[model samples]
Target: MRAGRKYFIYDVFTQRPLDGNPLAVVIDSEGLDTAAMQAIAREFNLSETAFVLPPKNPTHKACVRIFTPDYEMPFAGHPTVGTAIALSEMAEGNDLAGIFVLEENIGLVRCAIDKLNNGLFAEFDVPQLPEQLPLSADPEAIGAALGLGPHEIGFENHRVSLWSAGVPYIAVPVADLKAAAKVKLNNDAWVEFSPRKSEFAVASAYVYGRETVDHTSSFHARMIVPGNPSYEDPATGSAAAAFAGAIMRFDQPTDGSHRFWIEQGIEMGRPSRIRLEIDVAGGKLAAARIGGHAVRVAEGVLLA
Candidate 1:
């Protein structure tokens, strides 16, 4: 690695700079090993950092590996969008073909970048959805962790379950935004519900209400997994994806472009938005998708 190689980093899920989840992008990660990648992620101290490599199979697309400050992630949402947009912006003049496949630990993921008059839009696909788990029978313990009583948690037809589009999360419904804003990591209860170790499992928390925010129909969220890397993610695409799975499980809302918006981080003052869409028929999950626009917050060289 050269001493002056440049890297581009962006705060994804938010259009404004430094207001979203900060992602460190290592534009040229050729010879850096696993240990070096982890070290670089630690140096950036962000929730996730992307290391881009030349496609192992040129027939595929861009090869990328993702790492958190503590560990590597097989699949994640914002990194996919942010990295694809970065590559699309970089490959403007080149003869790179259409549909870039980002080969990662999860597998080969196809990404498409849209350069519209509005701005840049990046959309990526999750290979498969995580199996749905039954909602938690013990809402009291879960409720107490979020400083809410059982009644405060909504339980009409919706059940809190572990759903995933990429990574899994305990998806629960909160009756109000007030409760959502007060969420903090409940180490004790989370220990019981989360499958992964305390470090990985309890990654983020979300809360949404039908028609809660502006023009957002029937969904608003706040992500609260923030002790180590980030204070709070303004917008979390992975969590949004998980929430999309949860939404499909509960209310398989009508087809014909069922679009909804997710609002997060307003309580903490970051104020991020995520756009969501899903296709369902006869109570079967069909297609789950999430898209968002990313703006490059900062760019500099990642000194190797």
Candidate 2:
């Protein structure tokens, strides 16, 4: 038998185990190259995977690489939260409250870790703020792709828009939770109309509504990653960060620090809540952060 590497499974964006987005964190990723990491990610078959390596700069904590089942990403939210918490829990000292920098392709991301009563929590400021992209696709066409009609497409002052923080997403607003629940993504139509995020990829659809199952939640959302076999993300922090652009453009929150909880993954049964905090100054987004609770669900050795 070969000496295996250590790995952890964490449910992110929720406090409970098996209720949030699941992540695989490969801790002993010193010599694993890009191809090996991608293969490991495919093996886990989760939304995203994180590989931890020794930092090039000793001042920083580690260099974390993020990979989706399909390809490598510049940055991702759940993986950042999950990896930070996983590393903090592994630290030798009990004092876990502090900030550490994780080097990523996007840039150096500063993550703050805190110890909660139930589980550890982590939050990271988005390396790049949201930027609105041009979308020529008609609203009705967008609706049809999601198995929605024009009548149920949007609510007051909300419309289809394209935005990206690190990853791009098509922000689609629906009438209510009922419309959100009715969404069944047609991958073919989505590929036809969505903007290209890369040579081999297009933007994913982010469906949202004001109605939420949790009373404390400000909105309900679902993330649909467009592929041959279309799939839905239960809780997406990157989508929430991108959605902040749509919220600021429409709702126009007062200038200051604002906190909003978005509930997602209900229809899929893995319910999750993502915390979005935006600092508004002069009627513009000065900064933003994505935060969530992560619980270590399983730990084992990866034979690969």
Q: Against the true structure, whose lDDT is highest?
A: 2
Q: What is the lDDT of residue 162 in candidate 2?
A: 94
TM-score of each: 0.89, 0.97
Q: Any idea what lDDT model 2 has?
A: 0.91
Q: Assess candidate 2 and give its TM-score to the true structure.
A: 0.97
Clashes of 1: 3
Per-residue lDDT of candidate 2, residues 1-304 (tens digit): 1348899999999898889999999997998889889988999999899999999899998999999988999888999999999888888876667899999989999999986656677999988999999999999999999999999988999999999998999999999988999999898888988888877689999999998899999999999998988888988988998999999998999999999999999999999989999999999999999999998999999875
Ten-residue segment with the worst summed lDDT in candidate 1? 224-233
Deviation in angstroms for 260 in model 2?
0.4
Candidate 2 Cα deviation (angstroms), residue 272:
0.5
Instruction: State, as a TM-score between 0 and 1, how close model 1 is to the true structure.
Output: 0.89
lDDT of 2 at 225: 91
> How do the residues 117-232 of candidate 1 rate in per-residue lDDT, one tens digit apiece?
46677777665655565545476666676677777677567755676665766676877666676666666655665555235545445556563655654577766663333355
